[model samples]
Target: MRTTHALVQLALALMSAPQERHWGYELSKTSGVRSGAMYPRLRQMLDEGWLVDGWETSEEAGGRPARRYYRLTEDGQRELGALLRRAESDSRFGGLDLRMA
Candidate 1:
């Protein structure tokens, strides 16, 4: 997929806690991406083998449905690093802002 500013922001956010599993809503909030954009981008990443996803399992939790969580794979980390570096040198992305919520 082509790298956009939003993609860079999301990648950075995921890399922020590379070892931790992140849920959709939390990722949306932290990455400053709306739900509409975040979900589709996440699915695209999964399809491209950049992300691994699974449902959260909690036995102690009251009967709530499991939430899907995502973690960046090794390849994802490498791809993100390259993308971020490219974006840093690209003047088009200079005006973009990534604010963590």
Candidate 2:
């Protein structure tokens, strides 16, 4: 992984709920990364086999398209955790609460 700032933010966000499913938009909103940046990183994670994605349907969405959900694999937890640890050491990402809740 390249470990960009957006990737660090995404690691923090995903770590916050490792067991839960996430949508691209939700990740974008929480990580403060735009869709243009978010989706490509997500694709990278998927290609790296650190994450898996699937579709979801809910009455809550009503007429909207089925939502796509992503979840971290066991390897993802380790990868993201390592990413956060590196960020913790990097001065650029200092003082960021990069721990999982």
Best by lDDT: 2
Tens-digit lDDT track for model 1 on 1-101? Answer: 88876788798789888878988888988878888777888989999898999987776234888888999899988887778778877888787553322
- Each model's lDDT comes to 0.82, 0.88
Task: Give TM per candidate.
Answer: 0.87, 0.90
Residue-level lDDT tens digits of model 2 in 19-96: 999988899999998988888899999999889999886775688888999999999989998888878879988757
Segments of candidate 1 deviating more than 4 angstroms: 96-101
Off by over 4 Å in 2: 58-61
Relative to the unseen true structure, what is the C-alpha lDDT of residue 58 in candidate 2, on a scale of 0 to 100?
A: 70
lDDT of 1 at 45: 91
Which model scores highest in TM-score? Answer: 2
